[model samples]
Each structure stands twice: as structure tokens, then as C-alpha cells.
Target: MTMYSTDTPVNGQDQEVPPFGTAPIPGSRGEEKRAHLQARRTEDRADRREAAEERRRDREHKRRMKTEAKNAKVGLALQKKAERQKLRAKRRKERAGRLVELREKLSHHMPLWGLPVVLVSLAVGASGQADAALAAGMGWASGGVPILTEGMTLTLAGLTAQAIEQRRPHGWLMRATWATATGAAAINAAGHYIAGVEDGADKALYRAVLYAGASMLGLVLWWIVMRSKRAAISGRSAEETTRWKRLARRHPVLVRRARRVVDNTGLSLPEAYAMVWQRANGAAPGEPSIREIRASRRAAFKRTQAEAWDGRTRFSRTAPAPAVVVPAAVEPEPETVPELASEAAPELIPAPYLPVALAVPGLDGQWIAHRVPVHPLPAWRPCQEPGSETATTRFPQGQEPLPDPSPDASEDEDGTQPDEAQEQVREQVADDRLDKARALVEQAALEGRNLRRHPSNRQMARHLGCRPGTAREYLTQVLAERGIRR
Candidate 1:
């Protein structure tokens, strides 16, 4: 059996071809080409992979560098903040220490100087007291002499200081301190004088002065210190003392009363003074307190309420009279008219038209009361013609009817009719008022006020001190005289 392979000769070379369903031969040209192509793809993929790896590494490196830079900046900011906080803390501690030192110095400076003066006084006083006691023949009790003098003085002063510090009443304690201090100073001077009498008169005098000054110096210093401490505690400065002194001088009586109040009530001077002032000036003898006023108001309100509850009405409840209706143009027969009762008759009261004295500014700038006549409207009456049908009006009791208006009316003693004289006076007053109004308008115009516009009735009335209607009339006449239109 002859088995043939898929090989053919081409150009005098044997060409190996892969079978239809089999792989290519190991050393064939197709295998070599496929290998070359695969190798090219693998090299391309490896190059692309290396480029991607390099880019990833670069991104990581940049990210790490950025993170490190941010951390460094944060650490630097934190370091600066810590340094600032440390500096502030150090400054605060130093300031606190300085304040404490200042306070300690201020509080102790007085005692620091006072202690040395006290020690010197104690030594000098003890020597003086021992010598005095020895001269008095008290052998064993010579040491007790200083105890009675300087020791007693110091003890009393200390007690007085304690009383002042505690805000207790220390009047007697202060007096005792002064008495003991004076006695101790006297004793010290006497003892020194006795001891130096044998030396000479001048030596004795000098010893007395030295011993006395030494003994009193400590007491004086102590008194000053206590006074300063008391003033500080009570908030009474030199200015406050001067102010109180001035007030006391100004109001001695008030100060006396305030002192009494302070004694009785244990209140501060200001509080007591205020109390005394209120008692003296808040109200007069007849003036009531606010409590009394409120009580009176409440009583008045209760009385009013009681009156209301008892049906005691404030206004009258009586019915009004019926109205009389008269026709405008109708005439009634007198015999057919109903007669009105005495109680039902309406009184005819006239309007007030009396002459009033108006206070007006005169030429001298002083107010002068000028008499002005007020003209009233005339009363209306029925026609008194003969054969006229009109009802006669009734008059109230004890009243007279109006007189007839006729030319034959009586005249006054001055040879003039009363009505005529009244009319003339009214006209004269109107002329005077018109003149005053004109003067005022001219003055206003001269003062650069607009004269084209006239003042209103209220303003004119206020200026002229007259009624609005009268002022209006004066304004019209003044405007007419000036030739100004309405």
C-alpha cells in the first residue's frame, strides 16, 4: 500500500501544506510565519503593559508626594499653633506672678515699716517703765509697770482695731485706746525726767522729750494705720469725708436728725440722711401720701358703685315736653288756639350780646381793655296789623313782652336813643378793630411774610384776641381796604 502525504514540489523546493483537519508541520514556513506574528503581538502587548505599569507608578509616586507635602504643611501649622499657645501660657503665668507680687507688696508695706517703729517703742517704753517702778520702790513688780502702760495701750488699740475690722460699735474702745496711749506717754516722760534729774535740768528735759516722743510715735503710727484701714473698709475716702462735711454744714438740722436715725436704726449715714430728708421735705402737713390717695380713690369708686346699685341715676329721667309745630306760611285764629299750661310754657331766652372788655395791645405795647359792643339778632314777632289773623304768643310767669318797634320810642337823658347810641358804639368798635387788623397785616408784610394770602380765622382770632366770627369780619374789612380779592 502506497500512502501519499500533502506535499508538493514548487520551484524545485518541497512545500509542506497542512492537511485540512491537521495542524501545520513543526518546521514549516506557515509555522514560522505564525510564530513571527504571535511573537510580534506578544511584544506589542508587553510594550503596552510596560507603558501602563510606568504610568501607574508615576501616578502613585505623585500621589505619595502630594500626601507627604500636605502632611508637612499640616505639621508645620500644628507646630506654629503649639508655639503660640505655649507663648500665651508663659505670658499669662508671668503676668499672674507679677500681680500676686504687687498685691503682696502693697498689703505688707504698711506692716513692714510699722513693725520696726513698734519694736523701738517697746524697748524704750520698757526701760522707762522699769526705772519708774524701781524709783517707786516696787522691787519684784518693776517688770509689771510696762505691762500696765505700753502693754495696756497696745491691747486696747488692738481691740479697737478688731472692733473696727468687724464693723462693731467701737466708740468706747477708741476712747479707751486714746486714754491709755496718753497715760503711757505721760508715764514714760515722768520716768525719764526722774532718772535724768541728777544729771541736770536740761538733760532731764531732753530725756523726757525723747522718751515721750518714742512712746507716742508708735501709738500715733498705729492710730493712723487703723484709721486708714477703717476708711478703706468703709469706702470712705477723703473726698467722701469732705463732701459729708460740706453737706453737714449746709444742713445742720438735717444732719442732726439723720444722726438720730442712725443711732436708732443702725443704718448707714447715706441711708439715714435720705430717710431724714424724705421725712422733712417729701410731703407738707396737708399733702397726702400715695397710699392715702389710692385709698380715697377707692372709697370714691365704692361710693359711686353703691349709688349706681341703689338706682340713684346721675341724669334726670323725666320725659321731655312735646314739640309745637307751626306752619311756615299758615295763620291761626286766636280763639281756636289751645292755651299752654304754666309748666309747659317755653321760656324765650335771648342770646348773650353784652359788651365785653377785650384786652388788646396798645401803642405802648401794654394790654388795654377796650369795651366792644356785641350786636344781637332781633327777635321775630307776629304781624300786629289790624284785621290780621294771628295767634298771640304766651309769656312765662313774671316775664314782660317785648316792646313795639316804633319811631316814637323813648330816648335817653343824653338826647339820644339807646339803640341808636348802641349802634354807633358798635360801629366805632368795628372801625377800631379793622384798623388794628390792618396794622397787623402791614407789620407782617413788612417782615417779609406773604401778604397775598390772608391769615385764617383761628390765627386771626388768636392774634386779635377775639372770637373767630369777629376776626373773620375784621379780616374781610382789612382785605377790602387793601383792595385784595377773596
Candidate 2:
């Protein structure tokens, strides 16, 4: 610290001055200046603190808004995902139901399938393998006929082939086999319990009789199935067959049947015939009902008609009807006459006379007073004067009046020749005209000219002395003959 000096002089006087940092002597200028500086510094620091706080608040508000927007976006994405999952689940459920229905239908065909199995079992039983099958508890029919087991297995195999041919899903055949096996097991249990016997020979005989009866029953059922299948096949062929050359020559009955099928099925003749042939040969499944087929075809046709070239689909069936624009009713014009006078006068004015037509041959029409007043029709126009512009006559453009035949000219002795010389002249003229027309056609073709325009047709007709239609036809034929495409 420096020492204070109390001996400083000012303005040539002996006044003493205080130290520099000490509070100025009361009423001095330095004391007031120092206090003013202290207040300004404090104000500046306070202003800076307020500005920083405002900036922090502004940053917090922006961060809050950004977080809200992100949350909203995430929520929307999740909602869409949930809706998509719901739609997919619904579709999957519907597909599963259809699959179950299809499997049930396959299961019902088991009896028809058992026919061939029964036949095979009979042969295997005859070969004495029935005993071995029965001992193994795999076959209960006729003391375990080998054919019994083989027939069931064969039927399962046929079901598998049918499934594959029908383009069913992978597990269809497996489901069918399981259903058939269950059915066979049930049959075996029923037979074993019902045909109980004490002696071995009697039991074997009973079993043999039981097996034979079942086989016969299965055969009858098979016949029914075949008959139905035949019907289906025939129906399909009738619709598809339009022309069956071999059938026409060898089987007229089949042709007639095909026509009937066409009428019933509403299919093209060729398609019906093909389907019938497939059914007869057992290469196709049973035909659907006629109603179902027609309904499906109608739906497909509607869809086709409704479709546009663009990928967006317009569902016409569900589309709302267009709103009709009904014009607002106009107020009737006020009567020109005063309301009091119009109400006082009678509304109907009677005619003085009405013209009545007389049917008598010699009588002219006469007018008479009518019992009732007649209202005239709304439209009225003055009659057109004869031979005036309003009464013009229109005719076809190229028409010409025919010449009167001469009474002096008569047919020759054979009654076939009226004018041989004139006929020769006409033929010569026609030949010359054709030659000129050919030249014109060749010239036009070389120039790559189109003859379809009205002016072109008219010009050609004028040059050839023919009607425009005739000229057009000639040009068209020439173009075709020359292999020139339009």
C-alpha cells in the first residue's frame, strides 16, 4: 500500500487533499462519481443473469415439443402395426376353416374307396394269409385276411393321389388316411363284438360270411358312387363339347347328351365336352351343382366388367348410387289479369264450333257446336306452303331417274333378247370403266393415299361415274387384293 499525502495544493491555495482511495471529503466530486460507477456495475450483472435464464427457458420448451412429436410418431407406427396383424389373423382363421371343411369332405369319400379294398381282401383270404393277419390283430375280417389290411392301405393311397391331383395342401393326404384308419378300426370292433362264437371252425365260418356280406355291401355302394360320378362327367362334357367328330360318327346319343349338358351348364360346347370326357374316364372330380357354377361365373363376369386398366379396383356392387340433381320448383307466374276479375270470370271458354268428320263416301266434313269445350294442344305452327323452301323434297345424293322403256323395242323370237346391240355397248363401257378404275387404284396406292375420307370417296365416284358407296367398295376390294393393309 502507498502512503497517503495530505499536503497536495490546488488552484494556488493551501487546501489539503485526501488520499486517492479514501472516501472523498464530504461535498467533493470524486465521492459522487464512485457511487455512480458502483450502481452501473450492479445493474449490468443483473441484466446478464436475467438474459441467461430466458435462454435456458427457451431451450427447455423446444426440447419438450420435440419429445411430444417423437412420441406421437411412435404411437402411430404401433397402431398401424396392430391393425395389420389383426387383418392377417382374420385371413388365417378363414383359411383354417376352409381347410377343415375340405378335410371333412375327403373323409366322407372313404366308403366309396373301400370297394376295391373289399375285392382285394377276398383274394388274399382265399390265399390263406387271413390267418396270419388275424393272429397279428391287424385285421379282424375273416380271421385276419391279408387283403383286409392291404385294402385299407390301398384306399389310403388312393386318397393320397386324389389330394395331390386336386392340388390340396401337404397335410391333406395324412388327414384323410387318419380318418379312414379310424373308420376301419371302428368297423373291426363292431364285427368282433357282434360275431362272438365258441368253436374255432364255426367262428371262422362266421367271420367268412361276415366279410363276404360287407364286401357285397361295399360293391353296391361303389356302384352308386360310379353312377353319380358318371352323371357328373356326362354333365361336364355336354357343356364343353361343341364338335365331337368321332362321337358324332360312332355315338349320336352322346352328342345329344352333350347338347343337353350345354343347355344346363351354360358353358361353351367345347369346354362341356372336355369336362364330360374327363368325368367318364375318372380323370376329374365330381361336377359342382349347376346353380353354383352359374353363380360363380356371373360373379367372375361382373368382376371383369368392373375392372379397369389401372390397378385400383372399383367395387361396383358396393358403390353408392349417384346423387340426382333435382332442380328447385319454379313458382308459377302471377296471372296478368287482376286477381278479383280472374276469380269472378268462368275458367272454361266454349268453342263456337267443332269440325266433325263424316264417314259417308259422298259427304263433306261439317262443323257443329260441341256439348263441351275442348282445350287445344300447346304447340301450334303455320302450315307450310306447297313448293316452298319449307316444303323442300330431299333425295339420295347419287340417285338418277330410270329411262322409260320404248314401246317400239320388243323381245326377239326366243323372248330372251330385247337389245343385243345395246347390251354389247353396255358391256364394253363396263370393261373400260373397270380398266380406268384399276389404273386409279394403282396410282393412289403408290402415293400411299387413304381412300376412306369423304372427299376421296366423292372424287373417286365422280371420276368413275358411280355412287360413293360403290367407289369405296371397289377401292377396298382393290386394296385387299393387292395385300395392302389399311
Candidate 3:
């Protein structure tokens, strides 16, 4: 059943060709069907490849869109963070600026040393005392002395500073200082007593501190008294006058009426009178009575100000130009210069050049006389020669000039001699200086550091800026007054 194979070998290759005829053979038909199936498989594979490519493209598009969305979200988050950072930085800058402004405002009112001292004092009072007490294993009662001492010292310092700055006496401050010091001293003594008699260096050190504190307290007292004395000496009349002037400016009508009553009516009135008078008077005593003038002036000023602020005008005029009025020249009255009439002086001296002889102290108990022209009456008496009572008199015995005998003769007789008058003035000044010097010594003593080893006459004189003799005399006087031994 070999049959002739439908294939033949040509050029070493086997070829299968369909048999050509009106009817197709089964093998040929089978071959055709297999070819068609292979072609359909190829088309199916192409379609599948195209569909897979389309799916890949859609997935790539989805991934790209997701990536873009992620990038946009990240960028948006970064922008928000940047904005937040910028806002924070702005707030920080504003806070820093406000802090700087606050510091400047504080610096204006407080002195350079004041704020630091106050902070230190507060810290010490709040923490230091408690810590020290705890470390020492002392109870609150036992620690009271140290607390009071430190607190009172700080308070006194502040009070002293305020008093000096204000140049006035503060009675409450003095009273408080006294109370604190006394209480602290008592507490310290009691604590020491309760602790039993300590021996050795510890005891000595404690005693030394106690003494130092006592000395400081004494000095504080002296300073307070001195400041009070100085304030009293300065007088309150000037302050009263200044206050009156201030009130006059604020309420002219009230002040004017008050001044008239107090000055002319010989009435002893209180400040309430002025307050009542002010309540009664609405405007100044001599100002314009009508309201129309004031309203027009105020409206015009506001309009001009508004225009200037709006940049419509370069300049603003609040007040009208004053009218220039030429005042008539007044003929001055004839002034006659009076001549000094004295029997001792033959020559008539002009009022400006009336020479008065002043005797000044010279070396070796001698007097130096100088002729000074008198302008007006001097407040202080003329200087005199030293030590020889009437050795260098201003006027010769018989050549005494009578100052206007036409006036009261008894008054001239009551007038003191130039030397006596000068002595009185010197004495008064010395007294004041002595009081100030005592105050300074008290201050130095309170500092806990001795200003001078011994408060000698020379040291006292140096501190007082006075002569040694004067210092000695002042000390003697003070001692005598206080009933103290020499």
C-alpha cells in the first residue's frame, strides 16, 4: 500500500502540494482546514497581544495619574508647611519686637541698677532664706531673724533711694525700718538664747554679725533723721506756690478767685474752698463768654487738619495770623540818682558806687580791709576780722554812719554790729553742716565698713568739709546738747 506518495523530494526538500481536480481530496481538504485553523489562531494571538497592550496602556495611565496625584498632594503639603513656617517666623519676630519694646519702656522708669537689685532682692527673700533655713535645720521661728534682717535691709535701701530721689521725707518708711530692725534684733537674741551659749569662733562670729547689724540699724536711723531734717529745712512754701501755679493753669478762674480770697480777705481757708470754687466756675475768669466763637474756631481747625491728613493740602493753619499793632511810645519818667549823705564823708557818692568797707581775716591775727561797692542789701552779713573782737571795726568810733535818721531811731539802735551779725550767720550755717555731718557718719557706720578707724576731730572735719576748729566746736556743742561726756 506504498502508493505514490503525494509528496516528492525536490532539491533535498519534501513538498506537499494539493492535488488539483474538480473534487478535492480528503488529505488536501484536511490540509486546507488546518491552514485556516492556524490563521485563526494567529489572528486570535494578535488580538490578544493588542488587548494586552491596551490593558498595559490603561494601567500605565492609571499609575501616571496616581503618581501625579501623589506629587500634587506632596507639593501641596510642602506649601502648607512652608506657609506655617513663615507664619511662625512672623509671630516670633513680632514677639521679639514686643519684648524689645517692653524692655525699653521698663528701662525708662527704672534706673540701671534698680531692676537688677529688685530681682536679686526678690530671689533672696523668696528662695535664699528658705534654703538657708532648711540647710541649717532651723525652724521658721529660728529663721525669722535672718529673714527680717535681709528683708528690712532691702526695704530700707529702697526707701532711702526713693527719699533721695523725691527729695522728701517718708515717715512710713522710717517707722517700718525701725519696727523691722527691732523685731529682727529681738528674734536674733531669742534664737541665740534658745540655742544655748555657743563657744569658740562660731560664737564670736555670731556676736560680730549681731554687732554689725546693730551698727547698720543705727546708721539707718541717723540717715532717716537727717533726710527728714533736710526736707524740713528746705521748706514747703515753695512747693505750695508751685502747686498753686499748676492749679492756676488748669483752672484759672477758680485759682484766681481763691487767690483773691486768701490774699485779701485775711481768711484761713482749706483746699476744699478751691475745689468748691472750681466746681462753681465753668470757664476762665476773663475769657470770651459766647460759645459761637469757640465752635467756629474748633470747626475750622478740624477741617484744616482733615484736609492736611488727606494729602490735599501741604500745610495746615490752626490759628489765624495775629494783627500787627504799633503801640505808642511812652515817655519814660525822669530817674534821679540819690547821693549817699554822710557827715563822715565829705564827698557825695553815687547810689551805685557807695563803697562799704569789709574787714576780712588775714594771717597772724591781722585784718585785711577791702572796699566793696554796695548794690543791694546782702542776705549774709559782711565778713569780719578773726579773733581781735573790735580790733578791725567796719566803721571808726565817731564816724558811724546813721542809715536814714529820718526813719525810726529805736530800730537803728536795735540793729546788731556787723561782726555779731556775721557770727550769727556762721553759727547757723555751722549748725546745719554739723547736722548733715552727723547724718553722714551714721550712714558710714551703717555700711558695716568703718569709714574712719577713729571718728577724730580731723576725720570729722574732713567728712564735713569744714575747718578742724569748727568741727571740734560743733562736736563739743553736740555733745553738750546731748548731755554726753567729752
- TM-scores of the candidates in the order shown: 0.35, 0.26, 0.27
Candidate-wise lDDT, in order: 0.71, 0.53, 0.55
Mind giving the per-residue lDDT tens digits that candidate 2 earns over 7-86?
Answer: 33565543345555678557658646645665676787789899998889889988988998999999999999999999
Poorest lDDT segment (10 consecutive residues) of candidate 1:
388-397
* Candidate 3: worst-modelled 10 consecutive residues by lDDT: 403-412
Residue-level error in angstroms, candidate 2, position 434: 64
What lDDT tens digits, residue by residue, belong to model 3 across residues 150-222?
5775567557546645655456676776676555444444444334345655674575456435434443545
Error of 1 at 6 (Å): 90
lDDT of candidate model 3 versus the reference: 0.55
Q: Give the number of the best model, judged by lDDT.
A: 1
Clashes found in each candidate (C-alpha, N, C closer than 3 A): 0, 15, 0
Off by over 4 Å in 3: 1-35, 38-42, 69-73, 76-113, 119-486
Pairs clashing within candidate 3: none
Q: Candidate 2, residue 234: CA error in Å?
A: 0.8
**Model 2: residues with Cα > 4 Å off, grouped in runs:** 1-84, 90-94, 97-223, 236-486
Give Cα distance to truth, residue 8, candidate 2, Å. 38
Task: Kindly list the per-residue Cα lDDT of model 1 for residues 1-486, writing each as its tens digit.
Answer: 673332335655544444457776558796687557666877988999999999999999999999999999999999999999999999999999999887665343246656888878878878887888888899999989898787787778777877887878778898998888777777778888999999998999899889988887877887788778888888877877777787788789988878867866799888787676656656322344344444444555555558756443559585455578886986875777677758767767664322444454332224666443332434434575553143433332343444333466787688877556655655666666677788888887788876666566666776766778878888877877778756
